[model samples]
Target: MEFFNNHTKLFITAFLLFAGLTLLVCIIPALNNQSNNAPLPMAVPLSDMAIKGKGVFIANGCVGCHTQQVRNVDMDKVWGERPSIAADYADIHRTDFWRNTATLMGTERTGPDLTSIGTRQPSKEWQLPHLFNPRILIKESIMPAYPWMFEIKDKAQPGDVVVNIPEEYLGGRKGKVIAKAEALELLAYLQSLKQTKLPSASPQPAFLYGKVGEESDAKPGATKELNGGMLYTNNCQSCHQQNGEGLKGAFPPLKGSKVVTAEDPELLVNIIMNGYTGREKEGYPAMPPIGTNNRLKAEEISAIMNHERTSWGNSAKKVTVDEVKKLMEKVKVKAK
Candidate 1:
């Protein structure tokens, strides 16, 4: 009884018990998880610049809006090549000794999932400007701009990375938008968020409850290939809008545009494959190279083209897969 009543003994005993419980319930399990799960074969650790950029991403509260995980569902297919696995997050560790930032598989998706954004839109030309002002490219965008990550310079220095923002987005400022180190670092981090390829022999996990044959072999009579509507929804609908009436002063309206309604598909295909900047002087932001970046197949490109050419009250000639395939081959050759 005297021993129990001693103040120092009681305090030390209670503290030890509490610490032991925590070690059993929390630390031990965490250590086991880390040891059991290994990063995939092709996974590479983030670069130094990318780690700094990741800090910036957390500081800006990007995780509140954007998610990094792609769930096991057909809808999530647009965000990644496959559903996220435990190994995908095995490499993620604590922010530092003070703070432990777990895998950033955010709960809410106010913005699109970023698991495969590096592959989806790889161009820094599009990314930097969009970060400066998302609305500059996509008028309907609700994402906030990180203007603080950039500096306005009267004349870009020899080593400065100048961000070519459309003039109107500058808010009448008289200077070139130069990407600061933070912004460049953030770009590095965002670009580093690529999905690693799984081993060739390992069977990929099927997205359960999705269209049974979405990726399986095409049936004798059914068309398993994705349709135009789905492709457009996955790619262009974000910028062009559902009705093809792109917002005024930003993206040109595809509803009745001569380009969409044209008999020739060359210019439209080029714009899709390589991106469009001819209208930047007219104040429209440059379109990102969607087809090339996403690595769309010839059939997929043809489907997207036909959707644009015929939708939104525009009646145009449909393009064939072979025709677009030839154009794509030429574009790829030229790119090299």
Candidate 2:
């Protein structure tokens, strides 16, 4: 009773108890977790360029919009092959001695999860314009452009990599848009943001195991019909959009596009099989070869063409698989 009445003793006792509880509850557990002691997988080490690019990513507030962590949920299946584990980020370290900006496992998903962006969207051709003006590729994208990271040169010098930006997006500025060193570095960092394949000893998640032989016996026509909508959503909807009314001054609308309604599908087929640039006059960014990059089959390309031509108020003839196959063969022969 006397001790309870002593104010100094009570204060000391309370302080000590609180500090002990904090140490037990917070500090001890954190120190004891296996994540703290786990060995970093050797595969995902950051290169010198990637390290500098990570700094640029932090400086540009990319973490504010994009998340590196993919949650263990069905919704996240689109973002990565598997849900992210803490081990996935074991290799990431603090930016400097002064700051604790270690892993950029951002909370907000204002943009897409970048955990597997390397595999999802690997092409530098697509990445450059998307960084410069996301609207050029994604009609409704609110992502800000980093034009300062690039420069307009009258002509690219030897050894300079030119960005395939359409002149319309350049605001009629003359010359080629070349990515600066910083831009290349930033790209390197982005390309490095891939999920590392877990070792065989690690227990694999159920969602990571894809259904085997699901399409092995699928008929060509049936397969095309089945995959058409999904393929469009995955590959085309980003720019052309679901409604197919592409962004003004950036992406040409597919709703009433002449290309979609053309009788001769040769040009369109070639464009898909290869790629198309220099369409600045039509007020659209250059289209990358979705067929080549995504490795779409002849039937798949026909399916996409059929979907685009039939939908969006443009009633063009359905593109045949034979036609697409012939065109692809021609392209292959030309390349050889």
Candidate 3:
């Protein structure tokens, strides 16, 4: 007993020493700014909305359900661009280095990863309506209403107020109010969800090439001459016009547009085959996947696009039926 009591102090001293050493190993460099010189690579700055939405995202605990990082194999199969990298979070500055550590790193994801939500769903109006009430858009969603973050304003007043009343209440019923800034911020964060370098591959058809464009770049042949002016008058002139000056802001002006006149003819071919719609900058009322007459073959789409490209001082190479067929296959594969 006497010996055991005597060694208690030694035992305590040894334990304390070990703990102190562990603490030093963890804390010493952090306290002394040892790795502070290793700066993160710069990324594009977030919009004001995105910055605000990030705060809302943190506040509402969306991370409890959704994840940001995606695995490489899953991303490849989904064709979801690159996998999550720590560098992707370089722009996400946080005040407390400790509390915000995961924000700067990553967290465990439970729901479908949000790594590409921005590009997947880019319409601001869609996002706004979706946030006001998720069930309105996604009938099966389990998310709670963020009504507190929105305003209730009357449409009758026609003021500068943004409201969050249910769409049903728009018929002159007194509306509830919410904060526009908060909604805008939440959208900003959602819009920041895209994480890819090439959301859309260049508009080349794949069959013209031996394989998919991503797999190989084998170019296709020149298009065959067809009755382009008659085709335009009968089909395209209604929307695209005889001169190819489409409805400004509604349909794109094909005369000198980048997609039509690029050095690569694939750009024009892909659009005709797939049809597209994005931001105003991207073009609107995207050409229908099927032609206006609905039976225009791959050769027809190619000839028309090629003729348009050359007719308006476009100076780009022409598209061909084989290229159109190739891209059609690629788009179909991607759609799958």
Listed in order, each prediction's TM-score against the native is 0.73, 0.65, 0.49
Per TM-score, the best of the predicted structures is 1
Global local distance difference test of model 1: 0.84
State in Å the error of residue 48, model 3: 5.3
| Model 2 per-residue lDDT tens digits across residues 95-181 | 789987888989999999898787666657667778888877776789999999999998899988788776678897999889988
Error of 3 at 334 (Å): 19
lDDT of 3: 0.58
Q: Which stretches of candidate 3 lie over 4 Å from their true place?
A: 1-42, 47-49, 75-79, 101-110, 155-166, 169-179, 196-336
TM-score of 2: 0.65
| For model 1, the run of ten residues with the poorest summed lDDT | 217-226
lDDT of 3 at 212: 36
Off by over 4 Å in 2: 1-22, 34-42, 207-231, 239-336
Sorted by TM-score, highest first, which candidate order results? 1, 2, 3
Candidate 1 lDDT, 1-336, residue by residue in tens: 987889999999999999999999999998898899999999989999999999999999999999999899877877887889999999888889999885788989999999988877666766887899997666778999999999999999999988877778888998978999999999999989889999999889766676664555766765344589889877887567678986565567889889877887878888888888888788667787888667678889899888988888878888888798888877767766
Question: Per-residue error at 223 for model 2, in Å?
Answer: 12
Clashing pairs in 1: none
